[model samples]
Every structure is written in C-alpha cells, then in structure tokens.
Target: MRHSIAIVSLVLFVLSMALLLTLAKQAYIPRKEVRDLAKIYLNTTYNPWNKKFTAMSPEGVTAIVWDYRGLDTVFETAVFYLAIIGSIALARGIGKYSKPTSDEKKLGLSLIVKTVTRITTVSIIAVAVSIALHGHLTPGGGFQGGATAAVAPLLILIAFSQYFLLERGVSKDLMLVIRSLGLAGIGLTAIAAYFIGVAMNKYAFVLQNQAKPLSEVSIPAYIDGQLISGTLWFFNISEFFAVMAGFTIVLILLVIPERAFKSSGGEEK
Candidate 1:
C-alpha cells in the first residue's frame, strides 16, 4: 500500500513539473507594453510634480496596495483578524506554557539545530523589520514582513522548545495585546488625515496618503527629512506587529500536545 501511494505521488510530481515547464515558455514571460491601469499607477505612484495624484512612494506596489486600493486591504486585514479571534475563542484555557511539564523536559531538536536557530532567528527578525519599515522604498511590505517575523519564533519553538519562549515572557496574553495595539494603530492611521481635516474644516478622505487637489490635508510623507511615505510606513509597521503576534499565537496553541489537554480535563476544539 505504501509503495502504491509513493508511485502515485511520484507520477503526480512529475506531471506538475512538466506542466510548469510548458507554461514557463510563454505564460510567465513579461509583456513589453504597459497596460492602461498599470500605466496610471506607474506614472503617479512617486511623482513629486503630481503630488495631488501620487502616493509619493518609491515602491509602486506598496502605493497601490495601501493607497490606491486601501479599503480592499482593510477588509482583507479584518478577515485575518476575525480568524485569529475565532481560534483564540476555541482554544481558551487549555494550557499555561510558562514552564514545561515533565513529559516536555526532553523536547526540542539537537544542539546543532538549536545553535543555528539562535544565530539565524535574530538575523531573520532584523530582515523582517527592515522589510516592513522600508517597504515604501523597496519590494516588501506589511504582510510579507509580518510573515517573515513569525518564522523566528517558529524556529525557536521547534529548535529550543516552546518553554524557551515561555520562559522569556513570550506568552499568549502578551501577544494578544501586541496584536490588538497593532490593529488599533492601523485603524487610527487609516482615519488620521480625515480627523485633521474635520478640525481644520477642509476636505479629506479616509486612508488618504498624499494631499489631493480638493483636500489640503495630508499625512506627512517625511519625518525629520526621512521619507516615510505617509500612512504606508505606519501601516507596514503596525501590520508587521499584528501579523507576527497573530501567527505566533497560532503556533503556540498548535504546539500543545493532545495528551496534555486530555490530562488537564480540557476538551479539544
């Protein structure tokens, strides 16, 4: 039975690779001419001479995601937030992971893996921060950076054990707080310019990045002469924390052994 399954898997893998290779000839190739909507974005994304229309970010993709179609991104973020909340509700009061139980004392991988994780985890976190913070100037943005940040804790959980993180005060409650704050920050950043407009009695739109022709209100694109690209930088940083903590919460909950829950008289969700 095992050999039969293996033969089927091999055939499936071969077929998938062959199909991908065929598509690589044409489907994945870049088109030379600019399309209509894409051309509009490329022209206005970082144009200082066209501040009223521009998102004022070097990275066109980030501008499009957070500025051009921001409301759509907000809805997507809300869906992820709701999913996390649902998981937390389902997994309530199952375990306190501050210290390991006797059965867990012998957990974690070998010393070589642990040592490598220690080095790589810190570097990975640094890269994630840079990716989120500099997203308006480069390729990556909030979701990408947050996903990258989550990998560090995941590696530590596998390599050095969950107790290592628990001992270091990386608890679910703390993560929840961080996640909540990040979400709040994103919300505030979204409406910040609108509130300013109300106070000054000028026209402004929610999620507005650069000042439009009708509204003089604008989120500062620069801070102390540094190009933060208005709401894009704040959104990226907030989302980085929110996604990182949310994913870490999921990991911590998932790492709990079934036997552990059973022993504690907690029914599995």
Candidate 2:
C-alpha cells in the first residue's frame, strides 16, 4: 500500500508540473489588443487634465483602490480589521497570555546581530513610511507599506526580546487602540462629504468626492505646493496604521508562552 501511494503521489506531482509548464508556455503566446473594462481603467485613471472625474493620481492601482473602487477597498479593510480582531480574541480565549517577563523570554541574538538589526530597523521603518505616504503617486500603498513596516517589529523581536519592545512602550492594548483609530479615520473620511452636504442642504452621495456634483467636501491634492492626491493619501495613511497595528498585536500574542495561558485559565472547561 505504501509503494502504491508513493507511486501515485509521484505521478500526480509530475502531471501538475507538466500542466504548469503548459500554462506558462501558453501565457507567452501573443494575442491581439482587445478593448475591455481594463482598458477603460487604464485610459482614464491617470488623466489629471480631464475634468469629469479626477483621481489626480498617476498610479493607476492607487486610483483604483482609493477612488474608482473605494467602497470595495473600505469593506476589504473592514474585513481585515475583523479578522485581526477575531484572531486576537481567539488567542486570548485559548490562552490568557500575558507578555513574558524578560527572564522568561528567550535571550536575544549576539551583539553583532543586535547591532545590525538596530541599524536596519530604523531604515526599514523609514522606507515603510515613505511607501505609505507616497502611495498616492507611486506604486506602493498603505497595505504594502504597513506589511513592510511590520518587519521592523518582527526583526526587533528577533534581535531584542519582546520585553525590550514593551519597555519601549509598545503593547498589544496600544496597538488595538491605534488600529481602531485608523479604522475610524477611514470611516469618517468616507462619510465626511455626505454629512457635510447634508448639513449644508446640498446633494451629496456617500463617499462622494470634490469631483462629484454638489459635494463641497474635498481633501487638498496639493500641500505646500506638493501634490498629495487628496483622499488617496488619507486612505493610505489610515490603512498604514491599521495594518501595522493589527500585525503587531498578532505577533505579540503569538510569542506569549503556553504556561501563561494555563495560569490564567484560558483553556475551555
């Protein structure tokens, strides 16, 4: 039976590899240019001069994410927020974990590793912030930047103990607060136009921008003579904090020991 299973597995793996190769080869075959929904997005997304609907962002992906398909992105962020909250709740329920004491936690790496990580951590964080801030004009955005920033905490965890982070005033509770605040910011940004219009007795739809009729609410695209792409920048900024906090909370929960959970009676009765 073991021999037959191994033979079958081998055959399946080989067939899968062949299928992948065939698909890859087919992908290289050139096809004629076809006008489609994608072409519409590509054509209109980057036009700052066009007066109809101005995203004011050269990065098509950013425009699509924050302007064209903003509601979808907002819901996606909400889903992600819920998922992170669920993970933390589940972790807490399964194990009433607390931050491990310095002595209880594993010792960090050697001096050399610590030194390198310390230097790189700052650089990594700076780059991540740049990516998040410039998301409107560039290829990167909030999610990408936040995920990249998360590496800083992880690296700190590796080179310096979690206790060290806690000592520096980083905590799960703090992260949760920050995450909540970021989500709130996103929600407020989405509705600001609508509510303002309502107060002023003007016609405005939810999530409407300055480009839309009767909506006076708009974020400035230029700040101090620099183009920031308005609401896109705000969205990117909010998502950056939300994502970073969510990941940080998860990481902190993961590193706590099983014994801590037991002490707190986290196991199901």
Candidate 3:
C-alpha cells in the first residue's frame, strides 16, 4: 500500500512538472510602456503635485493594496483572522489541565543547535521588523514580515521546547491580546481621516489615505518631514503584529501535547 501511494505521488509530481514546463513556453510578457488601469496607479502613487489621486505611497503595490483598495485587503485579512479565532475557540481548554514536567523543561536539541538558533531567531525577528516597518518603501510588507517573525517562535519550539516559550511568557492569552490590538489598529487607521474630517466638519472617505479631488481631509503623509506614506505604514505595522500573533497562536496550540487534551477530557478535535 505504501509503495502504491509513493508511485502515485511520483507520477502526479512528474505530470505536474511537465504541465508547468509546457505552460512556461506561453508565458505572457509585459509591455514596455505602462497603460490602462496600471498606468493610473503608477502615475499617481507618489505624485506630490496630484494629491487628489496620489496615495502618497511610492511603492505601487503597497499603495494599491493599502491605500487604493484597502477595503478589499481588509476583508481578506478579516477572513484569515476569523479562521484563527475559530481555531482558538475549538482548542479552548486543551492545555489548561496539563502542566509541563520537570523533564519536559530540559528537553531540546544539543547546546550548539540551541546557541545557533538563539542568534538566528534574533536575526529573523530583526529582518522581519525591517520588512514590516519599511514595507511602504520596499517590496516586503506586513503579511510577509509577520510570517517571517513567526518562524522564530517555531524555531524555539523545535530547538528548545514549547515549555521554554510558555515559561518565558509566550502564552496564547498574551498573543491573542497582541493580535486583537493589531486588528484594532488596522480598523482605527482605516477611518482616521474620516474621524479627523468629522472633527473639522469636512468630508472624507472611510479608507481615505490622502486628500481626494472633492475631500479636503487626509492622513498626514509625513511626520516631521519623514515620509510615512500616509496610512500604508500604519497598516503594515498593524498587519505585521496581527499575522505574527495569529500564526504564533496556532503554533502554540499545535505544540500542546495530545496528553494535555486527555487531561482535560477533550479530544482536541
């Protein structure tokens, strides 16, 4: 049976590779000159002269994702967060009744691996932060950076142990709080201009990052002359935390021992 499964997998893999290679020959090449909808986004993404259409974000993709069509991305992110919330609810008390044993505390890889992971984890977090904070300026953004940051926790879980992380206050409750804050930040940032407009008795859209042709209200594109790209930076930072914490929550729950579920008389379904 195992051999049969392996052969079938190999055959499927080969077929997939062949199909991909065949399609590669017909890959569409982009035109040299920007035109149509893309041209508009590129022209206005960072135009200081055209505040009406400009998102004030230089990075076209980031501008489009967070400023031009932010609501769409918000809904997409909401769906993912909802899934994580459901997972958390399902695993409600799987680990509550079980405490890590003294031996579990000492369980991990060799000293050299642990030392390497210590340095590696720190570097991973640093890179992730750089990716998130500079997302408005570069190709990387919140989701990418947050996903990268979550790897550090996974590494610790593997190199040290889940108990090590939990002992260090990396609890699900704390992560959940952080995730909630991130989501709140996103929600607030989305309507920041609207609130400001209300206070000033002006018109502004819910997800307005910059002033439109008709609306006078806009989020500040710079702080003390430092370019923040309006709401894009805030969105990236918020999403970074949200994605990282959500992933960490799932990882923590998965690492909780099956026996932990047994102690709570729960099957961890």
Candidate 4:
C-alpha cells in the first residue's frame, strides 16, 4: 500500500511538472502582438522642453544579465573556475611513464598536420577577434569569441605534443592559472561595479554604451527592472572567455593522453 501511494505521488508530481511546462510553452503571445505591444510600451519621444525623457525604457535584458544579474554571473564564473582548477589539480600531476611514440607513418602527415594547424589557428584567431569586436552589433561577443580563441591552442596541442613546444605541458597548474585569470577578471568587474555606486545591471549598460555607440541605445525592459549595467557586449565577452577556458580545459584533460606517441603496426623487431 505504501509503495502504491509513493508511485501515485510520483506520478502526480510528474504530471504537475508536465502541465507547468506545457503552460509555459504556450504562454507567449503571437509575434505580431508582442511586437505591437513592445512598440507601444517602448516607444519614447524626446521632450527636451519639459526636461523629461518621456516613455523611455531601457534594454532590460542586457541590463539584467550584465549589470544587476552580473553578480550571479560572477559567482557562477567563480564556481566554474574553482571546479576547473580542482579538476586540473586532481587529474594531472607529477608522474612519469613511458610508451612507444610515433608520427613516422607518412611523410605527408607532418605536412598536412602542420598546414591544418596553421590554417585552423589563424582562422580561429580571426573569428574570435571579429566576434569580440562586433559583440555589440551582432549576436556573438567577447565571451563567445574568447572561447573560440581558446580552440586555437587546443588545435596546436593536437598537432604537436608538449615535447615539441619547448616542453610545454597542460596540467592542473595551468588550469588553475586560466581559471584564476578568468575569475579574477570577473571579480574585478564586480568590484568596479560596487565602487561605481550602481547595481550590476546599470553598470553593464553604462560600460556597454560607452564602449559601443549605438544609435538605438536604450536599456531593455529586463535591465530597466534592475540595477545591472553594461552593454550586452560586455556580458557576452565574459561568457565567451568563461566557456572557452572551460572547454579548453576539458579538451586537454580528456584528449591529451599521458603518452602521446606509439609505434605503428608491422615493424620488424
């Protein structure tokens, strides 16, 4: 009887969740209506005579995430970094072992790998830079771009092992460094916000607008609802670096083997 009751309870819980999700999915109004409402709610007229910015609304979403909500993002990044550093420290350490190593299979392999590495490295760098620079104007920004930048190193690592790069190694310490820098940057941004005597959302907008001069610069509704400030670009950049470093660390830990070389088949002993 108890088991049956528990099963019924579980079913009820699942059904409730399903109902909520369905409601949420169907909650949004039609796009045309939404746009019309936005126009009505957001449309503002310049009233210099009354010294009033009448009907002015901010880019609320940008403000919330980058400014007011930035603290959350900062702590989140901090936690992310802490986790990454911990993993690096735990997984990679001072150890020694030997195994057969080789890149001796084909003459063209070295050339191909080298070419691919160079092309990929350069291309990724360019893309990252572009994304970072135009983060405000377009969809992607620094965080996305920076993460993309991190890929270049991973590619290089794949093409050439630590031995080739003057004994460069990816270990726990390196992860700590990358994570530390990222977290530190985020912390500093937060601290700066406090000193500015404004909430995170407000600050994000101030900085973002300062960095990029957009004709239609207004805080989104979400941001207007809070104190976060900075252009969405800044937040985007932060996310980019955060994600980039994260994936890079994961790639190193997972893909870069202890022994990066081995013998090919059919070798005469």
Candidate 5:
C-alpha cells in the first residue's frame, strides 16, 4: 500500500511540474519576442542619424561590442587573465619539478603523434592570427584567437614531451614576454583613446558621410570611406596578448612533471 502511494505521489509531482513548465513557456515565448523586438527598435531607430550610422550598418554589432559596452568587456578580460594567472601560479607552486612518464620514455610516442602535432601547431597558429586580425569583421575576436593560438604550444608539449619542448627551445619566459607585450599594446590603446578626446558616444570615428573627425587616428573600414576607431582595435590586441600569455603560462606549468624540479635530496627543486 505504501509503495503504491509513493508511486502515485511521484506521478502527480511529475505531472504538476510538466503542466507548470508548459504554462510558463506558453507565456514566456511570446513575451520574449516582444521584449527583444522592443529593444532592437529602441537601439536602432531611437537615434536614426547617429552621426552617419544608419539602421543598415553592417558593423552595428561591432560598434556595440566595443563602444556601447566595452568597459564591461575590458574588465571581464582582465578577470579572465587574472584567474588564469592565479591558477597557473598555484599549480606551479605545487609541482615545480615533477617527472612524468612521457618525460622518462620519450621514445614510446608514435611518429603519427609527432607529425600531427607539428601540423596542428602551424595550423592553429595561422587560425589564431586570422581570427585575431579579422575579429572586427568576423565572429572570432582577440580572446578567441589568442586562446586558439595558445593551443599550438600546448600541442607541441603534449606531442614531444615537456622535457623536449623546454630543453630544445621555447622557454616559458619567452612566451610570457610575447603575452605581456600584447597586454601592453592594449593598455597603450586605451591611453590613446582617452587622449584623443572622442572616447564617448557623441562623436564617431566614421560613417556613411565622408566627413573625417579631427582626431589623428583613422583606419579605413570596408564601408566605402568608413573607418574604425583605432582605440577599439588596440584594446582587442591587448585582450589577445593577455589571453595568450595566461594560457601559455598555465600549459607550461601543468604539463611539466614535478620531479623535473626535484633536488638531489629528492625534494622539489
């Protein structure tokens, strides 16, 4: 009798949940459409002649990504870099010189693994660069590109053992420099924006009109004489470097064996 009661109760509970979900979806789907359409109308048509930006601008999303909400993205990028750095630092402290089986038995890896890694590294590097450069025009931006680029070195370490990668060349310090330089470039771009006197929304860098701003930095865009604010691209470069450095640091620290750092006394070296 108790088992039967429990089963009946379970069935009722599931039925109730399903009914509630159905009712909520029926209400929400239309409401969501209405709200989204309202928002689109407000942003696009609210200010029709936003200094040559029409409702038909193809770079509309790009403008919003950098100009409308760039501060948030900048902070988010900073947090991501910080988290990656913190994780790598923590891992490095715990395993400065541990030995891995791969390190000890480098001969065991197949030729296919070696060949694939080589090919993957080059391809990933190219893709990363492409993504970073075309970020303004396409879907992938600095962060995505940088993360992709970070994978190439990681692939090398995985395919050729940490010892081989570390000893033969490609030091962590060198990668760090490359990553830091990218971050620095981003910082400088922000500084440039602040100094250029048009960091806000009132004045745009370009438009359908041929009128150029009085500012010194104007790189031509695809829309005829349309150009992009150089500061936006600068920040993108910064983001790219920060991500690349953070990821590279994490990969190097994690892949190498803790035994590699051990002293003669068997303590971590």
Candidate 6:
C-alpha cells in the first residue's frame, strides 16, 4: 500500500509540473522592447547627469545593492545576524569545553601544512579586503568579502586547533564583540543622514546618501582624487567585519566537543 501511494504521489507531481509548464508556454508573451524601469536604471546608473542619484560604481549591480535597494541589504544583514544568533543559541553548551592540554593543542597537521597555511592565510585575507573595499567599483561586496576573509580562520582551525587560537586570544567572546561592533557600525551608517538632517533642520531619510535631496551627510566620492563609492564603502566594510566574525564564531562552536556539554551539566536538545 505504501509503495502504491508513493507511486501515485510521484505521478501526480509529474503531471502537475507538466501541466504547469504547458500552461506557462501557452501564456507566454514575447517582448521586443526593454522594460521601462530597466531602461531607466541602465541609462541613469552611471550617467554623470544623475550623479545625485547614481552610485558612482561602474557596476550596476553594486549600485542597485548599495544605493537603489539599500534597505533590502540592511534587512539581509539583519537576517544573517539572526541566523548567527540562532546557531549560538543551539550550541549554548559548547563554550563550556575545557581547554585542551598543550600536547593536545599540537595535535594538528604536520609542519609542512602549517607552514603553507600561514603563508596563504595573509594573502587570502588581503584579497578578501580588496574585494570588499572595491565592491562599488567592481562586482563583489561586503558579504562576499567577509565570506572570503572567513576562509583564513577556517584554514587556521583545520591546520592548527581551537586550542591554538584560544592561546593566541582569538576567542568566541572576542568575535561576538567584533560582530556586534560591525552591526552597530552598519546601523550608524544607515541612520547618519537622518541624524544629521535633524541636527541641521534639513529633510532626510534613513539610509539616504548623495542620491537624495537635503542629504547633508555626504561621503566623498573622491578622497584626494581617488575614487571611493562613499556610503557603499562604509556598508561593505561593516558587513565584511560582521560576516567574518559571525562565521568565525560558528566555526569555533562546530569544532567544540559534544562531551563538553555533558561535562558542563548542560542538556542537549
């Protein structure tokens, strides 16, 4: 009976998908002209005439993310924070793990692996920072850069051990603080315009940049003749730190032993 039910369900699902595809094809309408909104964004994205509204980023995607749809990005960052918080909650007892002995701390890969990791880690972090900082000019942004930076810590964790990091003062608590500071920076950047407007009796909105009128808080697009995407740079930098710290915390928690929970008299769900 179970097998018969499974077969029937599979057949129904397939039939539904087929019907949906056929209906979609039947209802399809071809368009020769570009969408009005798409054309407008394309035309104005990099145009000097639209400097007030245009993010100087040559990359349209970065402009849209950091300028046109900033609130969406802010919410996305918040969602990432919530996910990290959930992970921390789920692994509440892991932090109670006793410190490993000096010998146990050395129980990692050989000298060759450690040497290679040390050599590459700095380069990886540098590239990630470059990606993040150049996000407005290029394709990548804070989230991407932060994820890239995270590879360094992960490499260290694998090449060495958690105890090695702990001895060096890289703890979950420190990461949490870093993450919090990053998030705070993001918030401050987002509302800086609003606060400035209030202080100066001008009109402003949250996340307003050079794109909007009465936006007294302006980040310079060129600092000493060097191109910088202003608020976009700030956002990317904050996001890089937040994401890097959050991921590091999560990785550390994952590597913690299950025995730690039991030893600490903490219940497992």
TM-score of each: 0.85, 0.82, 0.86, 0.54, 0.68, 0.81
- Candidate 6 weakest ten by summed lDDT: 211-220
Q: Give the candidates in order of TM-score, highest first.
A: 3, 1, 2, 6, 5, 4
> Residue by residue across 1-269, what tens digits does model 6's lDDT show?
75998999999999998899788886456679888997877776666687666666677787788778889988988898999999989877443567665676367899999999998998999999999998877889898899999989899988988777888999899999999999999999888778877887877888865645546456567779877766778888999999999999999888887778678877767
Candidate 4 structure quality by residue, lDDT tens digits, 1-269:
75998999999999998889778896544554556644533342211132122222144333344544555755666677677667666665424444236553432237778778878888898899778655544445556686788778677666755334324565535654765565556555545433443543343332222221222334332354542223354456556666676767766666544342222222334
In terms of TM-score, which candidate is strongest? 3
Tens digit per residue, CA lDDT, model 5, 1-269: 76998999999999998899898875344543456744664465224355333232234454455545556766776788688778766654442454454446554367888887788888888888878766655666777788898888777777777766777767778777877787777666545533443654333333212123354333323345443333444555667777887787888877655454453234533
State each model's CA lDDT, in order.
Answer: 0.90, 0.82, 0.89, 0.53, 0.61, 0.83
Instruction: List residue ranges in candidate 1 displaced over 4 A.
Output: 1-30, 93-105, 266-269
Native-referenced Cα lDDT, model 4: 0.53
Q: What's the residue-level lDDT of 98 in candidate 5?
A: 42
Window of ten residues with lowest summed lDDT in model 4: 44-53
For all candidates, the clash counts are 0, 0, 0, 41, 10, 0
Error of 1 at 214 (Å): 1.7
Q: Residues 1-269, candidate 2, lDDT per residue (tens digit)?
A: 75998999999999998889788885354568755977777777766676456667878898888888989999898788888879877885553545645564357888888899999999999999999998977779999999999989989987887777988889999998999898988888788777777787877766655455445556567889888776788889999999999999999888776677677775645
Ranking by lDDT: 1, 3, 6, 2, 5, 4
Flag the better candidate by TM-score, 5 or 6: 6
Candidate 1 positional error at 222, Å: 1.8
- Residue 238 error for model 5, in Å? 2.8
Compare candidates 1 and 4 on lDDT and give the better one. Answer: 1
**Candidate 1 total steric clashes:** 0
